[model samples]
Structure formats: C-alpha cells, structure tokens
Target: MKMISIGQLAKRTGASVRALRHYEQSGLLDAIRQDNGYRLFDESAVQFVERIRVLLRNGFTLDEIRPVASMLAPQPPDLRTVCADVIALYHDKLDELDQRIAALMEIRASAGARLAFLEEQRRRGGP
Candidate 1:
C-alpha cells in the first residue's frame, strides 16, 4: 500500500511534474487523494507512465491511444485488436517517414545540381 507524491513520481519516472499533471488531465493517469489534498500514486504508476512514453515515441496519437489504453482497464483482454491497430499505425507512420525522406533527398539533389551549375557558370567567366 505504498504511494508516492507527484515530485517523487517524476523523479522515479524521469518525467517532469508538469508532464505528469498533463497526463492526469488527459485521463492517461490517475492518482489517489490524501486527506491533506495531496495526490498519491502507487508504484505501478511508474510502469504505466513508461508505457505511455513508449506509445508516444511510437507515434501513437493521444486519441488513438485512448482505445488502446482501454485494454489495460480492469476488464477482459483485447490484445489482438490492439496489436492489429498498432501494426497499421506503425505502417502508416513508416510510409509517411519514407515520403519525407524521399522529398529531402530530392531537395538535396536539386541543391547539389544547382551548385554544380553555378560553379560551371562561374568557371566560364561571369555570365
């Protein structure tokens, strides 16, 4: 029945206290209340916060995360559906990254070509 305050949680989780508060506001985390109006979180909350960090890093939108997090509630499992959704999301993000990379490569090539042409023009005397 051990619990920790917000500062302690932040120290343990390596997340800012502001971020923890935001997570609570986002319904991604919950805290118990002490009689003095202090917020207390169980040790398990550390793991939950880490999971949230992982999801965010993986490009999971907050809204999309809601449905996935629903699986972690005190209920029956829905892992298969969550896995499928995560796979699709990953594919979409990867495709977006690929397109971005291609655009950057094209821009770089164009810049290189322009520089080469300018160098050649300069070599031919200012024209």
Candidate 2:
C-alpha cells in the first residue's frame, strides 16, 4: 500500500486539513507519524474519508460512524445491504432519535401550555 502524507489525503478527499485532524482526534481515522514529524496514511484513507463525508451528510455523527469506520477499507459497500454490525448501529441510532423526539414532544407540549396561559392572562388584562 502506498503511504501518502496528510496533505495528499486532504487534497484527494477535498476535506480540510483541520477536519482530517479532527477525524484523527475523534478516532475515526488512523495515521503514522513519520520521522520527519508528519502524519502519513495509506492510500485507502481516501475511501474512509469519503465514507465519513457521506455518512455526515446523511446525519450520521462521528460517534455513530465509528463502529463501521474501518469496515469500508478501500471501498464502501452499498448501504442498502449493510452488515449485521451496521444494521445494529442503525437500529441504535434510530432508537436514540426516537427517544430524543419523545423528549422534544414533551417539552413542546409544556411550552405550548405555558404560552396558552400567558395569552389568556393577557386577554384578561392581568398585569
């Protein structure tokens, strides 16, 4: 495998250097530190970065994508036919989203009731 510098990876993926650094920090990508004090990566990192971009575009957070990040290797598979791990991750994300939605619904209901009470008070000329 050809080892490429971080600049090459950033250029190939059109991801900013800062974002690549963030990926490394987030444990979503890996690199090797050269003696010259530069980070290097295998050429396959292009695929990984692309996959990360696509997932982010589709609302997959870095944490959510971490489990399957390395599975893509040099190429990403068709997501419609995902592996068991990916399927489980999807289900987990869905469940998390459902819980968030339920919580938001409750908050919305409370806010709406408060708004209605304030409107009634205003209508009655209450200070």
Which residue pairs does candidate 2 place in steric collision?
none
Q: Which residue pairs in candidate 1 collide?
A: none
Candidate 2 lDDT by residue in tens digits, 1-127: 7999999999999999999999999998899998998999988898889988987876789988987986756643454455688778778878888999999999999999999999999999996
**Candidate 1 lDDT, 1-127, residue by residue in tens:** 7799999999987889998888888888899988998889987788778777777887666666766664443323553345676666668778978998999999999999999999999999977
Where does the lowest 10-residue lDDT sum fall in candidate 1?
Answer: 72-81
Q: After superposition, how far is residue 19 of candidate 2 from its true place, in Å?
A: 2.6
TM-score of 2: 0.78
Residue 121 CA error for candidate 1 (Å)? 2.5
TM-score of each: 0.71, 0.78
Enumerate clash totals for all models, in the order shown: 0, 0
